[model samples]
Target: MLNKSYQQRLEHDLEGWVKNGWVDRQNTGAILADAARGSSSTKIPAIIGILGAILLAAGVVLFVSANWQEISKLTRLLLLLAAMWFTFVVTVWLKRTSHDYLLEAILFLGAAIFGANIILIAQLYHIDNHYPDGLLFWAVGTLLITLFLRSRATLVLAFCLIVSWASIEILEFAQHPFWPFLPVWLIAAGLAYWLSFRFAIHLAFLSFMAWFFSSIDLLIKWSGFSDSETGGLIVLFLLTSFIYGLVMERKNSPLSLGFGDALAHYAISGLLLIVFFFQVETIEFDGWPATLPFVILAGFAAVLVLGTFIARSQKIFNLTDTALFLGFSTWFILSWFIPALNHLWLQAAIYLGLTIWLLIFGQKQYDKLLVILALIAFGCQVFYLYMETLGTLLDTSVFFLLGGVLLISLALGLEMLRRYLERTRDPQDSRSQEVAS
Candidate 1:
């Protein structure tokens, strides 16, 4: 039955193919029969072997001549170009005679040529662009080739180009005076992500790496470090590796999620940390009012929370949302405890009230986490107030009041979640029983 339905859908899609003169309805049956027979496509490994042998031969020659001081850079570049051109011509010919594997071989050759050309040009000109022009050009060229050849190898090359560009740009930003180029690298990374989604290859790892590097660079800059400084580079690397592991588990590649999540997380964390630490010192030391940091932190925390929830709902579960939530929660608690906010009790009450509202609305959908976080937060607020001995009786009274209200709210919230789960499960059990019967 499922196969029949799939065939119907295929026939429906192919109806347009007949209209466009791509295929005919009368030949659809034959095409389907041929497809069912499973046409034997050429594997990529065969072409890889052939191209690998040729490249290895060339590499040996290049390595043998490495000690030759008389070899001009231009001569080396020309030789590289000649080799690439020859490979291209041969691969194209093989594509005509052989199969898809030849196309993949050509794409691999194109990528090597692209990188070699960039290094050669950099050496010949004695100039470092400090931007990802090489990677950009290679990615564009590889993307074109992928489109023309319809080869996954070319697409993978494009993915690698974007990932490499992101990594290089981040390193450049950290070690050179090239902060301005970061946005361009981010845009390129975004384009790579969009392409991956279209092609369905799951390059999330690449995207994550790009974002992770960019974010760390920005964090260092925001922390008042010079662009060329190497203070937080190690931390960035470690954090990137940790996050990369998480991203790889969820995405096919770390680059697949693009750099947006990492960008957001770093930006929010840096901004919050700056406000919490440096901003107040800078303002107060300069004889400015201390209230400025509070206002700035409050506004920033609000925006971060709003943005994080929006991203979470949109299913963007990268590190950014997690960081934003943490930042906002910390900011909220600190703001209440700070010397500026005299109405800590009132603010705690209001927060508890809002949390209860969220639990009530969210629990019906089995959102236990929301209610659980709210409950934990309520407990913390009460504990914080209890610890501070500013009118102990008054503080203890407020704590008990908030705690009682939260406990009651949690009981109701759990009941709602229980009912929702029961309602959802009953239908599944009934269906199972019906199937068994």
Candidate 2:
């Protein structure tokens, strides 16, 4: 939902546009209505309801914990069961009343209590040997509720539970690959498609990513740590995901999605985070070698980039979009293949160049969040560079001075570009944003 301040700003700008003869005065109201429609104002009560449910659940747990010594097993079980049934009753009432969001919250609470009751009863019966199994049971039960209720909230909860279950199995029980999770993620994806919930799609993707990253050790067990740098592999994965987002976002492409922007944002954030680790120069950099995983990863990333390049409708290279990807991809692959490109100085230069590219991207796209992200990333990079490279006061002082000037210059350029873009932005584009929102 858009903030009130942002809405006010948009309204002010719309009025100016109306006065400038750029937009018809009569259409302004319709435009504002579209922008304000389906916003958080209507959803806030439902959110509060859900949050209250969660808080109530937490409080109940705390009470149970506090009275654990005093309460008998049967009484505790009965209490949890009663609470679970109570929520189900409330769910029926809300459903009859057509309070969908409240019904969802009640159902979610029931699901939580159901999961808790399972393990609690198991503990009482002395069958809670494998706690991770409890998580799986909880996830499965939640998914059943999700399926029956066709709830967005419960679907998300199920996704989280399943991921937690798989994570615990892998981390605590040495369950290799977590094979069952793949099918479960597919189920979640299918359900998301059926529901047409964009956030659920994000959760599905995240669950899959979690499964892959968590199972990396077991998936590559034969190679051992000597055969690969996990960091390099992760960076490659992120790069590939970024490219996939770009490819999927292409309007003319066969595959397109409304959620591709979110995926691209995640990949960009991951890339910047890795660059942060790079600048620190202390996050277990083993110097990627020509290993099997490296070769596979690099090849996969290359294929993605090349495939998209071949499919790109624009004959001219778009630096604003592709610059950051190309810079990082070249450095990442060449750093191992060509030793000369592996130096820290070159890496810094590449990342520095990427920061500027991201700034331009943000301005060109009229994304204030991305602009803010770029600024924060640049500031962090500078701070880390200064901290890592210490010297005599005069040398350090001069370096800081130059860095400040460079940063200020970038900021000015970003502001000027932002204004230019704002002026040139078509009325249709603003309407498109409202529709997208």
Query: lDDT for each of the candidates?
Result: 0.53, 0.73
For candidate 2, the per-residue lDDT at 25 reads 86
Q: Summarize candidate 2's per-residue lDDT along 1-437 as a digit string, tens digits.
A: 25677779889998899886679988988877877885678788789988987888777766655658578888898999999999988888888888877887788788888877876776667774778778878888888888887887788888888888888888888887778888877887888877778888888877787787677767767456532355566677677776666556654343334765567677778878866775455443345565676677768777757744743444322644565556667676445344465456557667776777777766765757667778788888767667656665676677668767987898899789778888888777879877977
User: Once model 2 is optimally superposed onto the true structure by TM-score, how far is the C-alpha of residue 356 displaced, in angstroms?
Assistant: 1.2
The estimated TM-scores of all candidates read: 0.41, 0.76
Tens digits of lDDT, candidate 1, 1-437: 55556667777878889986669679998877765454333343655654684485457345433534477776777777887687678777877896645556665666566566665666667657655876777777767665655555556667767667756766664533344445544544455455554332335443554465557655655554432222222323223332333343334455534443343234323333332332123221122214644454456555545544544554544364456444435544454334353255555555555455435533543546545655565565556556654577875876687678767887898789779999999999889878977
Lowest summed lDDT over 10 consecutive residues: which window, candidate 2?
310-319
Candidate 2 lDDT (Cα, whole model)?
0.73
Candidate no. 2 TM-score? 0.76
Which residue pairs in model 2 clash with each other? none
- Model number with the top lDDT: 2
